[model samples]
Target: MGQLMGFLNIERKNQKERSPLERVNDWNEYKEAMTEEGARKQAARCMDCGTPYCQVGVTLNRGTSGCPIHNLIPEWNDLVYRGLWKEAYERLAKTNNFPEFTSKACPAPCEGSCTAGFVSDPVSIKSIERAIIDRAFDEGWVVPKPPLRRTGKKVAVIGSGPAGLACADQLNKIGHQVTVFERSDRPGGLLMYGIPSMKIEKDVVDRRIRLLEEEGVTFKTGVDVGKDITAAELKKSFDAVVLCTGAVKHRELPIEGRDLQGIAPAMDYLTASNRHLLYNEPLESDLDACGKRVIVIGGGDTGEDCVATAIRQGCKSVVQFGKHGRLPDRRTEGNPWPEHPNVFSVDYAYEEAEELFGKDPREYYVETDKFTGDENGHVTGLTTGSFKKIEDGRAEQKKWDADLVLIAIGFRGAEDRLFGDFDIEKDPSGRVILADERSYQTSREGIFAAGDARRGATLIVWAIEEGRKAAASVDLYLDGKHSLLKS
Candidate 1:
């Protein structure tokens, strides 16, 4: 530890943000980064706990309890506290291929597992991480480091989301000729389109993509691997193919008026708005939530993002309904510290809504029975029934009032076309079935599936870990039994 008893002396002060009212006017990231001294002080709050649970990366109670990538949390914290920004950045980059993405988007299970949180506030791990990486970039330390020699083996990575990008980055670093295929007009499958710019700016994604390109990773955008170029042709051309297409088949809300004009999947609505903000494209007529009474179903991160998006788009009102009743504000008897704390806190969108609308826009234990529409068949309102939470934790019914509805319950699985085209078998959930748990190989040889495509939808850190492990597996598969790749 950089300073003994620093945790007792210092307090946790995170990166500041622009006020909710001031930030909603534009689509830029509202975070105001701290100075070096401020970040160092925050880093000093890391307690020197032997066997620190923050970096254990264990699955406790069906969720990750710590950093999934097993990042050297203490090492970087110590380095940052010592004012060694370069050393901190190096330690962070060693485990995380994309700290910029994870630091911004990850829910930070590491904080949940922090020992400090048992008594008082947890260490500001996420803020310190962002500070380290942002400093590295500003100091021109983050540069393109292409491999010295090529392995003479070519690999094709399908999709340009975090998983695909991490896989491509790793394979390229290890001397493989990697070409990433993206179906969208721009690269970054989810980072560019699925997520809003306010959470993570477009330029941040573009800068990382540029670095990947400069490091000899080829990117082919606007090329659908399974559609334009058949999977058979791709298999013949590349030595190996890794599928990180992501779990994107949004779960549909089936009921009466399911086909209403004003109801759309959360991803489709987000993508349309993202494109409009990024490329000056016209937003789809049905996708816009401007001046509409928006209703978002599901209380996950996607639903929260949609709430923020609709608010930014000038929605008349917004309400988010969660099937499960509200979680306890503090940990319950079954949920304790050092495990992934399942406590509830008001998230960003809800806070912003509170600031704007005088109260949190949330409903608990509610179910939307059906959508109601006018003669034109457009969604005007929804019927819901409210139920009291009991032993079974089921929803009965609730009331609803909405003009635009976003079904953000969750994703079912990956798109079936790519896997089907490649003759890869899918599990019952529609995810590409892996050959073995250790290796990310699919049902077919010379092919692999990682991230959400192999496992169900997971965290970005887990996705990166999968991509890294899958890259090692692909390297071994190409180089034979005695392959020296890191597995």
Candidate 2:
């Protein structure tokens, strides 16, 4: 470690955030960068544990424990502490192809497992990571470095989300020709659309896309792979195909008046907001929450984001419903240290809601029974319920007023249409292009699956990890040699 006693000497410092009152007025990134000295001090707090559990990516109890990408957390922290900014960026980029996205959006699992977090706060790992990458860009240290030679093998990667981008970047680095296909006008799948602009700016995604293009990864936008192009065509045109399409099928809340005009899916709402913010065009539909009493069903990051977005859009009022009971602030006995704790958190959105509404908007242990609508077929209110767990069962019944209902209950699986058209075999979950953990190969020969399409909807870091692993498998399938993408 740089100072050895740095953890004792220095205090943890995180990125400054915009004031809730002011930041909620518009859509923009909330967190401000910490000063260089502050970032260094935070980096110095890394104790450099003997094992470094923060980088030990694995599954515990069927969930990701540490960083799925197995990022070299302590290594980069040491590099930052030593003022080796470029080297820190190199080590950071070696594992994560897109730190900008994860630094901004990921729920930091590494921090949860941090050795320092057991005694005090974690070493501000996420903030230090953001600083390292931003400094790298400012110093002009990041540049396009195409592979020296071409392998003459071409690969078509479906979907331009995090997983697909990471896969393309890795394959391109190893001298394989990579082309990413996106159905939307933009290249970044969820990063470009599903997420609100307030969290992650679209320019950041565009900048990375530009870098990938410079690095010889081609991007084809507005091209539906299974529709405009066929699976058989891709198989014939390219040596291998990798499905990186994310789990985007929004879960529906089917109840009375569910077909009301004013009710919409959370993705549809967020996507419209993003498109309007990014492209200055009107939303495809009039789905704004403005002036309406917005009721966001399901309490997750997505629902919280809806609260934030609705506030910014000047909604009359906003409320979030959670079927689960409120969690404790600290980890319980079942979830001990080194495991990502299932604890209650007040995210930026919640803070903004509290500041604006004079109270937290979340209502826990509640479920929607039915949607109440006016004669014009527009959502007017909602029938709600409180749940109580009985012996081997659960029970509920209640009601409330909700003019605009946004269901944010998360996704079920990837759209089967894309896979069905290709005749790709799927799991019982109806997820695209089945494959094994080790090989990541699909039922169809020379085809592979990774990320959300292979697994399920997960974090950005997991998607990146899957992309790297799948690229290795694809490389091995194409040529008898192993891929250098392995961490």
Candidate 3:
């Protein structure tokens, strides 16, 4: 480390964010860049523990703790502390294919497991990572590096989300001819549309896509695999096929009056908002949240995004409902250090809503009972109830106004249409194209799966790891030897 006792000398510092009042009025990112000196100081706070649990990506007792991709955290932190920007970036890129995206959107499990966080604040790892990548981009060090030799093996990756893109990038780097198929108009799947523009700007995604294209990866956008091109054709044409479609089917609240108008899914709403931002097009009929009293039914990231978007679209008002009670401000008993603490958090969207609405928009311990509709069958309001889990594991509901209801209760699994079309065997969870950890090969010979479609809706870091592992498996399957793809 550059400063052996820097942690004792300096307090932790992070990037300043735009004030709630100022940032809510625009769609730009709320976080302001920290100066290079400030970033170095923050990096110096890394205690660099003996075990370094932050980089030990593993789950114990069904609880996940550290970075899923197992990033070289302390190495890069030391490099950053030493003002070795390029070296820091190199160490970061060694494991993470898209540090910029993960830095912006990941929940920062690494920080949660940081040794410094056992007593005091954790090092600002995400902010330092973002700074390193942004500096790399600014210095023109981030550029296309095509493989020196071509393996002449073709690989088809379905879905261009983080997992699929990471798989394609890894395979292409190893000199395999890789092509990515995306159903949307753009290359990035969830990163392009499901996420709001304010959190991670679309330009960041586009910039990386451009670089991948320059590196000779082919992208076929607006092409549905099963519909436009059959799975049989893909299997026959490409040396291998990797499914990374992601878990996208939104779980619905199937209570009475669910058929009423003005009730939509969270992905639909986010997709429409992003489309409007990207293409200047009118909002889709089933997706707009404008000029209505909106009630978001879930307190996760998607629900927070709904609150922010409704406020931006001039909704009459917005509120979020969570079935679980509000989490404690700090870690609780049995939730010790190095585990991802289930502590309360105020995200950027919540801050925006608080500034605009004069209060936090979240209502915890609440569950939707039913929806109320107007004469024209439009959603007028909703009936909700306070839920409490009893000793016997039953929910006791106690009945609250919902005019527009959004079911952001998360996804169950990936859509089954493509899996069925390909005759791919699924796991008990109905996830597509099952494969063992060792082989990453499907029930069928050359087919494979990775990312959410293979696992479930997980962190981007996990997706990248799966992609790299799947690439190695595919390489070994093709050439009878495994390459340096992190498997």
Candidate 4:
């Protein structure tokens, strides 16, 4: 601890944000950088605890208890507090391959398990982390350090998301020639298109992809594996193949009139809007929510993103529906302190929606029944039923006007289109069948699976962890020795 008992005197203050009224008018990051002094003060609030649970990454009761990548939080906090910016960056780089992505997009499960939060507010760890990485880049501390010698083994990574990128990065650093294949014109599977710019600007994603290219990772875009090329050809061309295709098959809202026009999946809507913003292309008429009464039918992070996107698109009004009731203000008995406390707070989208519409757009305890359409098959309104809770009975149905509807329900599993072509065995739920409990190797010897393909839909941090471990497994298989690469 750089400053003993500093937690007693310091009050928690997170990073500032642009005013909602001003920020909603443009597509830029809502958060502003924290001052050096503010970040240092926040880092100094780290308490001297013998057991640092913040870095003890694990799942308890099916909830994340800490950082999944096992970040060295206390060491970096002390380094930042002592004004050793470069040292902090070094420590951060040892664990996380991309702090810039996680600091902006991740939910920050590390702070939920902070020991300091037991007595007072949790340390602003995410803000300090962003500050360290940003300073490192500004000082030219981050540069390409590719391996001096090549191992003469070629590896193919089949997706360019966080998991694939991390696996490729570790393998390239360890002297293997790695190539990444992406179906889209650009890399970064979810980060490039699925997420809105308000959360993380596209330049940040591009900056890392460019860095990877400089470090000896070849990226081939606009090439679908199962369609453009056969899986058997890829297996013969590369020494080994790693599958990182994410869980992208969105779950459907199979109510009546699902075939109606103006109803679309949330990912499709986001990808279209992101393409429009980045490439200046026209948005599909049904996907565009401008001047339309938009209704998002799922209450999750993706739903929130839809709400924010609709607001930026100049929607006449927006509303979100969640089947469950609102969360409690404080942690319940079932959710303890270090178990990723399940509580309620106003998220950025909610704040922006409140600022623009003069009320929160979320309607809790509401479930969609069916969609009503006009003569042209365009959605006009929807029927919803409200209930106090799941344990109780449902109330009478009510009608709400809606011009566009976005189904933001979560993903079911990975797309099964390529599984049969690859000759890969998949579980009934569509996840790849691994050889064993502790291995990343699939039923096929040369092919390995990681990230969402094996684990279903999960957090980005877990995906990175899966990728690192899979890289280690691949390295061991290739060289017939224990891998030195960190997992």
Clash pairs for candidate 1: 384-398, 385-397, 385-398, 386-397, 386-398
Model 2 ranges with Cα > 4 A deviation: 284-286, 389-397
Q: lDDT tens digits, residues 409-446, model 3?
A: 98888887966777778887565557777778878888
Per-candidate Cα lDDT values, in order, are 0.86, 0.87, 0.85, 0.89
| lDDT for position 114 in model 3 | 83
**Cα RMSD, each candidate:** 1.9, 1.7, 1.9, 1.3
* Candidate 4 lDDT (Cα, 0 to 1): 0.89
Measure candidate 1: CA RMSD: 1.9
Residues 1-487 of candidate 2 have per-residue lDDT tens digits of: 6468676677777899999998988788999977778888899899888998888877776656778888999999999988899999999998999999999988888988888888877788999999998998999998999999999999999999999999999999999999999999999988989888788899999999999999999999999988899988998999999999899888999998899988889998998888888778785434787787899999988898888888888888899999788889899998887888788888898888888888889998786788887888888888776764443376666667777889999888888786676677887666555788788888777889888888898888888998999999999988889867565
Which of the numbered candidates is closest to the native, going by highest lDDT?
A: 4
| Collision count for each candidate, in order | 5, 4, 1, 0
Name the lDDT of candidate 1: 0.86
Which is better, 1 or 2, measured by TM-score? Answer: 2
Encode model 4's per-residue lDDT on 1-487: one tens digit a residue.
Answer: 9578887788888889999999999999999989889999999899846888898889998888889898899999999999999999999999899999888888889999998887888888899999998898899999998999999999999999999999999889889999999999999989889989999899999999999999999999998989997899899999999999998889998999899999999999999999999999999999999999999999999999999999999999999998778899998999988989888889988999999889999898887889999999999999988756456765768899999999998888877776786788886655544434466888888798888888888888888988888888888889887655545
The lDDT ranking, best first, is 4, 2, 1, 3
